[model samples]
Target: MTEAAELPPAPQQAEAVFGDRFPEAVRYGELLADAGVRRGLIGPREVPRLWERHLLNCAVLSEAVPEGVSVCDVGSGAGLPGIPLALVRPDLRITLLEPLLRRTNFLEEVVELLGLDHVMVVRGRAEEVLGKLPPVHVVTARAVAPLDRLAGWGVPLLRPYGEMLALKGDTAEEELKGARAALSKLGVVESSVFHVGEGVVDPPSTVVRVEVGESPGGVRFAAKRAKAARTGRARRRR
Candidate 1:
């Protein structure tokens, strides 16, 4: 059994912890369990940790995400954060962008099975797709890439005032430091980190929220040209 299952049943405890958000969390938990069963992604014994590690881990970031915003979850595999976020915040429109064909298919099925109309799945890499779309209010990611690469993927898709919320492990601070150069290249100027629950897992989780800022003339012009060149190459290869 997963670690989460070994612990005592926490349904009531979870409800008290989440308050009004409990019902949705529980329902989504069921959906995740069902999806895992149908896809054989996890053994029946593994559902509990999947619920806690994947679902709740992502759900807590909802506290960091601002309300009434359009957000995109980059490289969303199996729709962890995006799907759970849609369940909790019915008002926020979430787009899940996945590059792999099979994963994208899985995401679509999960959304349909869960009756999540607020979630949309796009098939493409973030670097290729993010620039084409209009900037969104916020971007989220989990286990997709390192902080530096994630910043590169997310910054281009964010409005000047938009935010990027990344679910990371204990090395979040170190990753943020490593990502400083990349962030500057992408026009992200400020960042904040928040630690989530303790003792749920080793090397506990944190959320890194990055804020986009105005790029200087030379930097902005250079970034635009670089993006254009990259897009051109991608189309040529296609």
Candidate 2:
């Protein structure tokens, strides 16, 4: 059993949406409010509204997930969207992919404390871990990068035709429009904005959904890939 820490009361929004799952969700919230703050992953001021803003904001994205599939949360700092996702969807196999040791340590502990057997803590950036990581049906992220750059890192890690569901703020549509050129080259077949969690979370949650092509793959790092391509061309001529 996970030890409980002092926590703000679970937001009514959480109970309203999560229903019976509310208790377990609340436990996870307590864990985040304490450890996540002490570790600097969550700002101390966020503790009061953590349930509404952080946990619920992330959890509501579950509305976009198809049932029973593998999910990888890239750059899963403090396990946003990832940990909450695992807590809500016991069926999903979630990988919390984080490059930082301190954050991964917190993620691993949270998984252990919450007894989330379905969640895996992977410590590495998407660029370094893509080839080594198993291709998953969905790649989740929040505060990761702009649409174009995120595709560069995420598309290669997905199963062919899989999707990248990025939690963008209000700029989702604008970002999608701006990324068309990059998306074409990065194997993105479709890109759109989705508003999920209607009644559960106020204002709903905005997600940028990018679907990869049937044979999808892309550069791991933009600058590095460009340099490598130029070098190859120069070497061929020489």
Candidate 3:
């Protein structure tokens, strides 16, 4: 691990990105750089870029979301995008879904510190939490996985017309090209690349937006097989 970097107050430009939510956003950034790194949810080296690369990158995702709908942040490590979005959009209810206990503990602490009554943290994989969470209008993630696999996790969490807004960075188009077969199998419609926050952040945030259910069926992985595969992969990785 690199030398620990200090968590910063929201940079001056945070006001430009988050407006009145600047203070809370900064506080969240500080916690993420500090506790999040200490707990291994974030790397120590990422501290310097937390504000620009993580918080703002996630906050700007709000630009793609329609107003007044519930959202779930899939694999929400350190509450990127989810907590920031909630801070800015009181109209939306946000859930932070993560499978790891350490990440969830940190998220819960941050949620309470931020007084984010609207956000809840669930400690479970997306597959494990099905039927346990309310269907949300949008599902979101950042750096989670390839689109094909991410869609397998996210598409099932959406309401009939709900969408998955996966932040794919520079590979957005390439991932989209690769995910056609997966999206088709998953019953998604209108999958496209959306570049949000063009002026708010340099280079903008790239998102692959896909609506679930083309003909009354949403995308679903073979649950039992997926779970088994995930378990084997984890064991091997360990």
Best by TM-score: 3
Query: What is the alpha-carbon lDDT for the whole of candidate 2?
Result: 0.84
Off by over 4 Å in 2: 1-6, 219-238
| lDDT score for candidate 1 against the true structure | 0.72
In the range 1-238, model 3's lDDT, one tens digit per residue, is: 5344687656666798778778888788878776777678888878888877888888889888899899999999888779888987888889999998888999999989888998889999888787778878999998999998898888877888889999887888999999998887777877898788787677788889998764524424546556788899999999
Q: Single out the weakest 10-residue window by summed lDDT for candidate 3.
A: 214-223
Per residue, candidate 2 scores C-alpha lDDT tens digits across 79-117 of 988988887788899999999999999988888878899
Alpha-carbon shift of residue 33 in model 2 (angstroms): 1.6
Judged by lDDT, which candidate is best?
2
Q: What TM-score does candidate 1 get on C-alpha atoms?
A: 0.77
- Model 1: colliding residue pairs: none
Indicate the residue-level lDDT of 195 in model 3.
89
Q: Report the poorest 10 consecutive residues by lDDT, candidate 2.
A: 1-10
TM-score of each: 0.77, 0.88, 0.89
Tens digits of per-residue lDDT, candidate 1, 4-82, equal 2232244433554455756666655665566545664445675757656776667667677788899999988777688
lDDT (C-alpha, whole model) for all candidates: 0.72, 0.84, 0.83
